[model samples]
Target: MIRRTFPILGVLTAVLLSYGLYEALIGAPTEQSMGDVQRIFYYHAPSAWTAFLLFGINFVASVVYLIQRSIKADIIALVTAEVGVVFCTVVLVTGPIWARPVWGIWWTWDIRLTSTLVLWLIYVSYLILRRFSSSGQTPLMAAVIAIFGALDVPLVYFSIRFFRTQHPQPVIGGEGSIDPKMLQVALINWAGFLCFACLVCWSRYRLELLQREVEETEALEALLDSRKAQ
Candidate 1:
């Protein structure tokens, strides 16, 4: 029963995400200020949110893996970290694209941008640490790194908030609220991005499982060969 349900769930998620993307791109209204470039918001905001969500998953899974010593939890944490890194890269790339036209700059050392950059570096380091650490220490070291890296999320949010208060609010959300149509577009974009993220994470996790199974089989075969030789 459980095995049968995953395919159905995957199909449903794909359909919903496709519909949401259509709504965001063709149906939703454009921003009066940014024009067509505003469409990037559909991809950008959601990428940022999904990246944060994935990192949160990694943090929780890492802790669980450490406590339970379950390979499943470790696999989940590893998969989530990788997916989160990809989304974070998207967010970083799209942010500059959106900013170039509006902010008249490609990059800035503003609090929000700086903090987000820091978060990206933290997770990238997490990935590196996991890759280089000795096999026996991988799980314990990864858990510690994930926990420490997650602290950057709250710091980034607060830094952005404080920065806005100190500096003039960006044209995107300043002196008023988002238009109703633009807001709807943003929401739909978020939904599509979230569904896509889930799909990617699921695919990666399955691949990881397959690799582990292959390794286990090889190990078993090696043990059998050793016994036969004896």
Candidate 2:
């Protein structure tokens, strides 16, 4: 059923993303203060939200895997962590670009910015551990790391509320307000990004499952050959 739906989902995702691009770049009104540069916020904020969601899912999956030792759960944890890192990378990159012109610098060590960078680094480490580790307990270790990493998400989210920072307070739910039309466009872009992220995760999950099956088969064949020699 899922296989059958992939094409349909893929097409829908493409349309949403393309329309989102059009709306963000042209259809949406330019900001009075930042003008064209503020346009990056459409992509930037949505990417951060998507990354936060993916990391949250990763945290839950990792916990499940730790408790049940289920291969499926482990695969899900791995997939979400991988995709989450990519989305977080988008946030990190776009943030600096957006900051450069506004802040007159490419980066800052403010609480929000620093914590976000740390969150990205932690997940990047999780992926590195999964990729390079030869230990049988790699999944367990990775799950532990994932849980630790997820703790930072809240800090990244609330830093602006708690700390005086170079980063502006969140427009959605803070002291500041946003134009309704810009908010609408931001939301449309977010919906598009959410759909795209789900599609990517689903595709990655399938590929991971296939790769594991091949590895297991190869291991089993080797074992059978060694037994026959005995």
Candidate 3:
């Protein structure tokens, strides 16, 4: 039953996400200041939020994997980290696209922007580390890296406070206020992206499981061949 339900849930979520995108692009009101280009916010902000959420999941799963020595937790952490990297790339790319129109530049060295760049690099390095690290060493090394890397998230969030920033503060959640119509679209976009993130993570996790099973099968076959030769 659980197996059957997942596909149905994925289809429903995809449908809602499609509707949200249409509402974001067509139904939402345009910003007076940035005009049509401002519509990118629907995608960009949600991508950033999803990246953060994925990284958080990776951190928690890493902790559990360390404590429980569960392969499932490690697989979930690995899958979430990969998904997080993809969303982080989306956020970084789309940010500049939005900024080029609004800030008159393709890139900025503002605190938030710089810190986010660093955070992306850190996670990318984490992925590379996992690739090179020995299989037996993976869980401990990955858990440590996850803990250390996640600390950057809070720094990225508060970077503007300690340093100068050309980037604008979050209008929806922070002290600044946003237009009602903009807020509505932003919220819907966020929901859509969150659901999409889960879908991607689940798919990646399943793929990892399949890959592990294949490796185990290969190992067992090699052992049996050795025994037969003896």
Candidate 4:
């Protein structure tokens, strides 16, 4: 079931993403103020949303693993954080691409931008601890850190509202209104990205499961070898 479903999901995601790219790059009308560069919104906005969504999943899995000490939950938390970080990287990269033209600067310490960088760094550190640390309690420690990192998501989201920044206002809610056509394009693009993120995340989870299984089998064999020597 997993084999059959996963490929289907991947194929569907690819198809959706193909059309979404056209919609974003060509179908959407250029913004009056920002012109063609604003088209980055189609990609940038969806990336940010998907990153937050995946991180939210990471948060839930972290909580579940902490509560049940389930290895499956740990796999979920790890993979989602990895995939979420990838999308977050996309957000960080695209933000500067968009900003360079509009803000005339490639980077700034604006509240929203700074908070997002911090968010990305926190997750990157979590991944480092998981990979490099030899602690038996790594998963538990990472889960605790994930909970705190998850708290930052809300802060990143609200930073534009809570403080003044060079970052643009929220597209979903503000005094400004998006054109109906552009809104549709954005929605379609977002759906495509959501599907794509799910596909990549599912693949990563499966790979992690296999890796974990191999490690346990190797450990078992090593134990038996020691016992025979004894």
Error of 3 at 38 (Å): 0.6
Query: CA shift at 75, candidate 3, in angstroms?
Result: 0.7
Q: Evaluate all candidate structures by whole-model CA lDDT and list the values in order.
A: 0.81, 0.85, 0.83, 0.85
How many steric overlaps does candidate 1 have? 0
After superposing candidate 2 on the true structure, give the runs of residues whose Cα lies further than 4 Å from its correct spot.
152-175
Among all candidates shown, the one with the greatest TM-score: 2
- What pairs collide in candidate 2? none
In model 3, the worst 10-residue window by lDDT is: 166-175
Per-residue lDDT tens digits for candidate 3, residues 1-230, read 86996787688778878888888889898877789998888888888888888888899999998899899999989988899999999989998898887777888667667777888998999999999999878878988899888876677767655655455543222325688888888888888788777887777888889998999999999999999999
Of the two candidates 2 and 3, the one with more favorable TM-score, higher being better, is: 2
In TM-score terms, candidate 3 sits at 0.89
What does candidate 2's lDDT look like per residue over 126-197, in tens digits?
A: 999988888578899999999887776676667644554455543322226788888888888899888888
Ranking by lDDT: 4, 2, 3, 1
Instruction: List CA RMSD, all candidates.
Output: 2.9, 3.3, 3.2, 3.3
Q: Write the per-residue lDDT of candidate 1 for residues 1-230, one digit (tens) a residue.
A: 84776677677678767876787788778777778787888788878888888888899998898789898899889988898889899989998998898778888766656766888898899889989998778878988888887766787778787876688644443326776876776677676677677777777888889987998899999999999999
On residues 124-210, what C-alpha lDDT tens digit does candidate 4 reach at each position? 999998988675788898999999887776777676445654555433213287899988887888888888888888888888889
| TM-score of every candidate relative to the true structure | 0.84, 0.89, 0.89, 0.89
Considering lDDT, which of the candidate structures 3 and 4 is the better prediction for this target? 4
